[model samples]
Target: MQFYVGWSHSDALFSDYYSDCPTLVSAVSDNQGTLKRFKNKPNKLIIDCGSVFYVKQQKRPTLKHVFEIQRSLIDECPNTSSIRLVHFDEPMFNKTSLSDQYYAMERTLYNAYEYLKVVSEEKLPVNVSTMGVIQGFDRASVHYSANELKKMGYRFFGIGSLLAKNQKQQIEFIKYAIEAVGAENLHVFGVTGITQMAEMVRMRVASFDSTRPTMAAAYYQVFYSNPFRTYVISASRAKPQSDRLGEPLYCECPVCKENPQDMFIPSPRPYMRLRSIHNYYHLVKTIEKMKVGTEREEVV
Candidate 1:
């Protein structure tokens, strides 16, 4: 399984530091210039239409406009071997009524069809594959959404708006999607939980993305792998949500090797970035361990 780290324009140097990192960037957040900053590095990238950014707006950009933005970002990464372009989808987060949820699902299907049509007409390169976004509220809706996208010739599919759901619901919806489309090319969006990550691996998901490392670092929390524990930075004024750790653990990551103390300093944004890098390293290690354990079980 591939893990794409959610990226931001402020962390443009991330690719330079972690050359092997697979990254996901939002078209609404990062522009072509931001992508160009890491063009020399050949890492896998996912360019997603920032539907969540426009979810609250009464008016959203046209499909053509958003597709153009995604295309422009794709152009900046000629060296990137793999690029997944996700269609704009109407998120189902705030929709409570059945009618509202139905409308969101319909809008998402419409966008998927139109996006595929545009991709065909534009003749996007083979390396640039389009992912159909699946938006639904229940098992039946989820199956219907996935089936429609499959009918539209979407080999790569992603399910989103799951951030609002509980873990059991999230896993159920994911299973529904896999049942409809299979797990070979299915991607789960915005997954952060360790248990969920392990479940995705067990179920053989193609990929998932998260910004948890950076988000945790910004909140003055640090991560350590192996046993997979989190701690609050000792110097941080933020109330300890987890155990407080004054010193960094033994890590071979560039940030830790250079100056482990940088992670403990919570003031400057650069320090936070360093902490995020360290946290990301541990998260990646945790995923790798999970993968290895899963593989060994299968072999046994």
Candidate 2:
């Protein structure tokens, strides 16, 4: 599965702490300044409405408003792989009542349908594809959303409001959605969780996005993906992995080459950037291994 990193601002902002990743997921409304930098760029562009379209009275950007932003982004960046319309997801973890959850999901579907109708106009660019969003709290409702999106002609569907679920819970959710909408067309929104990356790749996820590697680095922690497991080590206790293991923390990563002796960076910005790069490199590599069942017992 291709990983699309959700970036809120210019990649230049994280340039110092760069992950060296190319496929970017940006909200149409927030990434205007960065959009121009990638004109005909080789990297993949994935656009979506930046925020959930269900905020309170004045705080909200309405469904129509989100669609307008999406239209504008598409007009400016027609090469994007796909763009998702407004999704009215329930609160994180889906804390609301089932009835309320279903209501919000239905609203999201209707809004996406309406937005697609508007973008079907002759004036809009046709190269960019569209992805609908699937959202709900329970099995039936989740399937309902996914199946309905398929019927509405959405080839790509983003599964939203899943950040709070555990790996097992999320797997179930993904399974249901996949059964309703083919796995090749599903994108798990805002996720590249460690516990599930192998499983997700096994399940044939079309793509996913993650901010954790960069976010953890910003908070003075290092995200390390070991051969057997993942670790988030605090920079305060940082040391050479060889201190105990008799080998380098990560000899192959650029970060390790730069900080060869200590295997730890004192400067926050550089440390964060290098850690992010190392983490991303490991994650991408690990999934490749899992895909072929190479050294399959290693992760366990």
Candidate 3:
């Protein structure tokens, strides 16, 4: 299973672990500015250069621009294997023209798939995954778009925008689309709760990204201050991983069990210090537990 950790803006915004850790990293980009910034990072990282669609809803640019961006990254970092092209679709109500929105979406999706299929045939390795995303606020529309893309030779699928709120619905939709499209790999955008992880894993969805462990580490330091209030705030961000009454327990991770309350500090700001030395120990340990099966004796 390929674990895709998505960085919302730039890969630079994430901690050093993203650049150094072997876990796969996916980054979003709409323009060349961020592409120039991140296409050079070393590590066993695989980038998912997001959305080829423009926001203005005008005449789409010639397909040459999409190829150029892909070509630029390939030239700079030949090791980058997977390229997940996202498609940001506008809501039906907001669109300037309603003339065949479905047809237009299908055309763009086909064009993007055809562009990558051509590249794969010539220069890229046959195994290099060119994943496509379905962008829509509604689950049904997203599923429909994903199915259409699959018909155009896309095997992997991505879901965006709708995930931040209706994660459960996203999971259900992806499950149906996976069966419909015969998708081997599915990625859910912008969510990584413990419960959500269990569900995704069961559904055999390839990967999902989240800053939950990092956020949990930050919550640990503040929990002791006003345990109830801190738990309330942190719970809103991500569900608790363990049962420890608001202490932000990390029982599944060995480092947390060993270090306990010293895992993080709150002197400065909570978010900035989330990746501090102590927090990293637990964070890495948590990741290891998630990746490698932890023995009872080790975690206990």
Candidate 4:
């Protein structure tokens, strides 16, 4: 399974630190200038329309406008080996009404179809591919959405609008999508939890993306691997808890090796960035361990 670290403008300088990192950038948040910094880096990139950002907006950008943004970002990454472009998806986050949920799913499917049509007309590069965004509220709806995307000739699919759901619901919806469209080439958007990561590995998901490391750092939380764990930074203004750490753990990550004390500073944005980089290192290590364990189980 491929893990794509969510990238932002602030992460531009450190983006190249992890040579093997696959990145996911949102068109709604990142611009061509921000991506230009990655022009020389040969990382795999996923550019999504950032539907969740516009979910509450009364007016969203036109398909053509959004497509142009995505295209421009892709152009900025000339050295990237592979780029996946995701269509604008109407996220079904707070839509409690069944009708509202259905409308969101239908709108998502419509966008997928139109996006693929434009991609075909534009004749995007061989390395560039479109990912159909799957949106639904239940098992039946989820399967229907996946089937429609498959029928529209989407070889790669991603399931979204799962952030609001519980773990059980999230796994069930993912399973529903897999049942309709096999797990091969299927990516789950906005994954954060360790248990969920393990489940995805078990399911053999093609890929998933998350900004957990950055978010955790912003919230003064730190991550350690071996057996994945989180701790609140001891220097944070927030009340100290049992898991609070006064100093950084012994990590082999480049950032930690260079300045482990920097992670505990918790003030300057650059320090937070270093902490995020360190946290990301641990998360990737955890995923690697999970993958290795899964492979061993298969062999057994």
Candidate 5:
């Protein structure tokens, strides 16, 4: 699966190394020129409403909100390679009623259908691949959601509201959904992290986006990984690592190559940037390995 960068980060963190990977630009997280700037690169654009219900702590938007974004995307950024129609997600922590969850799912299908119908009728150039966001609380719900989206002519589905699930639950949802919707048509939104995803290399996914690696910067940590394992460099000397061995940290990553000594110092923001780059590199390579079924290391 190709990993897309989330919109909440500074674009400078996105190096030319990732120019081929599509980046996600959310209406909620990005300002003007972000999408256009990405458009100038080799990267494909993945546009979403950025309606991360739990992260933003908001209710599902009205059809008007969905329709407006659909129109705006078609009119303004019609060149996007992929467009995810707005969908309602009932966050697991919020404990929304089952009825409410089902209601949102129904509305999501309606929104997706209407959005596609308009795009087609308008003769918009967004005739690219479209993804329907799917949310559910159980196996049956997941299956139903997938089937409903398929009926709405959405062969690509983004499994949402899963960032909070444990690895097992996440795998369960993914496995069942893959069985229900077919693996070729699935894209996971905001996957948990590299390790969890690595465990899932047994399954194939079309694409996914993640921002958790960037959070390591805030927690005063650095991450290094190969496909099979991830290493955390705490820089606290609680454990013996190269920084304490009087050895230079060897890496070609922009941060490590240009700012070798910076890894020894513990600054949250810079470390976050460096580590986010480090983790993202591993993730991209990991997915690449999965694609070819050649495993020198495991990265998901």
Candidate 6:
């Protein structure tokens, strides 16, 4: 199991050793050049393009361009462990009563597979995992989408949008998908923070992703609250802040740990940066704790 962390649509930030946890980077637009930069880092990167809705809207590069990134990664980083492809957005099908919007997204996802097969045919040495996006605003929609994708040759599935909604409903959606696809082949998206860790782990997700660790401290200071509650607006900002905040306290992480309640500073935006760093540490530490607990349970 791995946590897809330290992600930015543009730059690299999880450079500190303490912040060095297994993370996944975006793989949009055949970003071989970019992937190569972090090639030797302690992380497994995934190429995450927006969802089918985004594809249809042309928010990212064309399907062909995304494949080109695969080709580039293959050509550049020959020794990397594996690469993941993500359809990174919510299912619009559940968003509206209109069937057209739903089908349009579905068709876009289908087209993605065709493109994936073509990329796979090129045959890179690394393992290629495809993420299945579950749709609908409710349990029924999630169930339907999961079953539909399982039928379509997806080995790994991802459940997004549903996570932030009803917890029971989200778990129900994940439980059903795992049952249909098998627990060993499922990955849950956006399962971050102290709130969802236990529940998500119980769901038996092979891996989960979040930006909490990178943003916790920033959130705490910005909101002047507890580490367990405040929300960090963006993950990109969290990565760097985690580094800066994790510095000094001999954090071992490039960004060491610091007092969560330090006064806000305008220069270098210490306040915001500290919060992000604090969030990253919290995230990394929490995951570590979860792993230790799981290991102990197996022993007992």
lDDT of 6 by residue, 85-132 (tens): 764443453454557546744764675457557656766564666677
TM-score, every prediction: 0.94, 0.78, 0.56, 0.94, 0.76, 0.70
Question: Candidate 3 local accuracy as lDDT?
Answer: 0.47
What are the RMSD figures for all models against the true structure?
2.8, 4.4, 7.5, 2.9, 4.2, 6.5
Q: Give the number of the best model, judged by TM-score.
A: 1
Model 6 scores a TM of 0.70
Tens digit per residue, CA lDDT, model 3, 167-191 = 5666666666566555456766556
TM-score of 4: 0.94
Candidate maximizing lDDT:
1
- Stretches of candidate 5 off by over 4 Å are 9-17, 37-42, 53-93, 227-248, 263-271, 289-300
Using lDDT as the yardstick, the better of models 2 and 6 is 2
Please list all clashing residue pairs in model 1, or write none if there are none: none
Full-model lDDT for every candidate: 0.85, 0.62, 0.47, 0.84, 0.60, 0.53
Model 2 lDDT per residue over 183-248, tens place: 898888877566676677789888777876666545444444447444435344544342223234
Tell me the spans in candidate 2 whose CA falls farther than 4 Å from its real position: 10-24, 37-42, 52-58, 71-94, 122-126, 224-248, 254-263, 266-271
Error of 1 at 122 (Å): 1.2
Question: Which lDDT value does model 4 have at 233?
Answer: 88
Better of 2 and 5 by TM-score: 2
Clashing pairs in 3: 51-86
> In model 5, how large is the Cα lDDT of residue 193?
58
Give me the runs in candidate 6 sitting further than 4 Å from their true place. 9-12, 15-20, 28-32, 52-60, 73-78, 87-90, 98-101, 137-141, 215-254, 257-278, 292-300
Q: Candidate 1 residues 88-135, lDDT tens each?
A: 888998899999999999999998999888888897877898899988
Which residue runs of candidate 4 sit more than 4 Å off their true CA positions?
12-14, 39-42, 240-242, 294-300
> What would the per-residue lDDT of candidate 4 be over residues 43-119, giving only the tens digit for each residue?
78899987877676789888888888888887777644699999999888878898998998898899999988888
